[model samples]
Target chain A: MATIETPKSQYGQIADLLISRIQDGTYPPGSSLPSEDKLADALKVSRVTINRAVGLLRLSGYVKVKRGSGTIVRTLPVILRDAKARYAARMQGTGAGEVEARQHNLVSNTVYRQIAEVPAPEHVAQTLDLKPGDPTLLRSRTLFANNEPTQIADSYIPAAIAKLSPELRNENAGPGGSYGRLSDIGHGPARFTEDVTVRMPTEQEQQILELEAAQPVFQIWHVAFDAKNKPVEVAKHVMPGHLWQLHYGWDE
Target chain B: MATIETPKSQYGQIADLLISRIQDGTYPPGSSLPSEDKLADALKVSRVTINRAVGLLRLSGYVKVKRGSGTIVRTLPVILRDAKARYAARMQGTGAGEVEARQHNLVSNTVYRQIAEVPAPEHVAQTLDLKPGDPTLLRSRTLFANNEPTQIADSYIPAAIAKLSPELRNENAGPGGSYGRLSDIGHGPARFTEDVTVRMPTEQEQQILELEAAQPVFQIWHVAFDAKNKPVEVAKHVMPGHLWQLHYGWDE
Candidate 1:
């Protein structure tokens, strides 16, 4: 390959060169790139310029640096935007005619419902106004986009309402998923609010999510309300932090 | 101190003893406990049992075990619960009181307006509905509880609304803190949501938060809504992960 003499001021251009190489598999995830000195010499740029370019990549989450260890390429997770506008924009560009954002790229879907006998967690019980360990339906599913796990969601519904929805027992549901199933049963959630937090992965989660030891997982705890302005269902979603982008719109 | 007798269930007793010592500050945070054999003999327990107990603690995040190295006591981070009913329950009887749960104990609070103009990142721009380079108000605070560092939150608001709130200028207007201030100004947030994730700490965050290299931080992104159903503020909070106990609630 011909060595390109990139300009010192063109840090972005140099960073793009590395990104392209990684995309082409020239430097696979977890692989180390050439030393800064070597790269600077090869690119015919001062090491300081090369350092600045690498700094940008680090901030952008492209590569990771270790004090004694060399810089290593990072694996970018499958990112899904949480903003509705962004979702609509992406969906519009898809060739499929009005496909559900989830089903359009469905990797795996599951629905499990019991007699709602599982004890409610302290947090869940208080929110639902039930005694701790109250019976509730625990429905969970893992979603994958392009063969990569994107999100895992666990939802709990009070037995009173879940029992009313026989359709929920059906094995195959449409793109509407749980939210739709609840609506079909006449307990549609009119609004939802979520509390989000992020933290480093536990050993098991790190292994299951195929994430780096340092990669954190995002947690979204959502509570949906019914028409009477009553809380109905609570759901928890966990995903690799880098994989999802959250967005919202507000009036000035 | 008188050594407790070696109970028939030696491992459990051993684990309990060590945990008590750690909690009471004998094995204070970041300090290493005695070796397996030393601890086992001191507590008259078998090495196997001692190892198992340590393993459990590591899993529960009470301690960090290094390969070929000793186990170190982990510092617990104070958890900021979601804005919900469950928070009230957990914090009760903790001696901090109910309103204490309403706000993180403020350690350092400062407000600055137009201190500097910086481009909004892609995600921030979308949430605030501003061009990428539009100016925004950046509010930063460090929270403390039990006289120890708890969490650090940085909020970015549209420059326009921020200018309207004198609290931002005076530094002490809202009773419930910034959230309270929003409501006092008729922008009382009716609905709020947050997304949380956890991962390894950045070297800088770890140092600033006085966290060890082995520990991680939790990052939470929150958005508050006003009566007009508009997003009035978007804030990012980062805390040491070990001490937090996240809570959420929903009504059935």
Candidate 2:
């Protein structure tokens, strides 16, 4: 293994110490960090040095700088997205999302955006086995937690499958979301695969998400396959990376 | 859904156009982008504008600025860590990691680091259902892809299990990694859970991984559970986020 390097600089060393405190609950989340003056006096360092150390913490999403208030430790994510358990729950006709919301004391909701038939992009076409520029059905929505915008999903379905399920063109796809509509058409989803990649958010995404400084966004391509091993729905979800953590579990 | 904002600045517009081209494979991975002068002339914008446009791409990790080769699109991650499939394959006595290494035409290896039995940290103790500062076995290793330092894993085993399996003291825990030795004492893992969070790397982590600018690191807390639903092992993996993509699939 590569040898772990010890921190050299005073500020980096201070930051590491503070991080350990955060991990150990010495400084709990949702609590304000002591002022730079207090910290510097406590650590016997200059206020400027303390400020830089706190800046590093902010950059790492450990803390946030609130206007008119002190630096505060950001709260841990209220929801944990566990894919395997979530799918299993959904398959059984209930789900984990609302249960988590209740557990976290947050409400969940979604807002829809209307979009007309659109041409499939290159990647989407390849995934859905269609030619680029082929017409497809699109469902656009912004999911919220406690009325705060969280994830934006854009689901695309092939023309044939869309025709088979006319509800795909509506604002609501009835109960199980679009999966229920597909099931009605005898193309129920049997399996799902998701690919996740990270990137600095575009200006539009930042504005939409009201993202914090140095926070990144993840683009997840989620493909749903039917029992016959045929891909049916291709959805792309954009989420703020800092506010979310993905969990995966497998039964051996 | 939130309305998408149009790029206001000329440079931002150019960046969006270039990003679209990259997505469409007009500028493929490992390919050089057009020089500032040529792009300025082609788009009728100043060289300064073109430079700023390319800078956005660099920050977003779409491309990297080579010393004299101009900007080059970064190649995609060769390994797709499909969690469900990988776990099943491992249980069946084969795995996806090596198969992906062969397919990507790369070599994979591990470098073991010696770590003495240390007190379980607060989080590890909580996950393993032990008291804080409880003695535990440690396995530290850095996984390499094509000889490049990719991921660092620190696995902690509870004392009882460690005593049950003598090999836990050694660097190599025999065949199926630690899980195999685990099976020897009838404590084979029956389930696994992983929780991931993202943050900027510490100075030492950045040095160890040789991370690029604007890249983030992911901390994954993985736990293995026995058939009786008892937690036995807790491992932490630190990985460069941008160079890796995690895939999760589930059956209904």
lDDT of 1 by residue, B1-252 (tens): 111122234544555677788889999977888898997788777789988777545533567665566788865434555445422232232212233334654333222222233466667778777788777766665555544556666677777777677675444444555555566677765666666555445555654565654455667677767788777877777777666655543332
Give the range where candidate 1 chain A is weakest over 10 consecutive residues by summed lDDT.
Answer: A90-99
Runs of candidate 1 exceeding 4 Å displacement: A1-140, A156-166, A173-187, A190-208, A211-215, A219-236, A245-252, B1-78, B83-137, B156-199, B220-234, B242-252
Q: Between which residue pairs do clashes occur in model 2?
A: A1-B111
Q: Give the 10-residue window scoring lowest on summed lDDT in candidate 2 chain B.
A: B91-100
What is the lDDT for B156 in model 1?
Answer: 75
Per-residue alpha-carbon lDDT of candidate 1 for residues A1-252, written as tens digits (9 for 90 to 100): 111132334665687788798889998977888999999999998888788778656644567775576888875443434433332332234311123244344433232323234678889888778888888777665555545555666678887777777554443343455556677777776655666665555554554455554455667777888777667888777777666554333221
State the displacement of the C-alpha of residue A251, model 2, in Å, after optimal TM-score superposition.
Answer: 1.8
Q: What C-alpha lDDT do the candidate models reach, one value each? A: 0.60, 0.77
C-alpha lDDT (0 to 100) for residue B221 of candidate 1: 79
TM-score of chain B of each: 0.64, 0.79
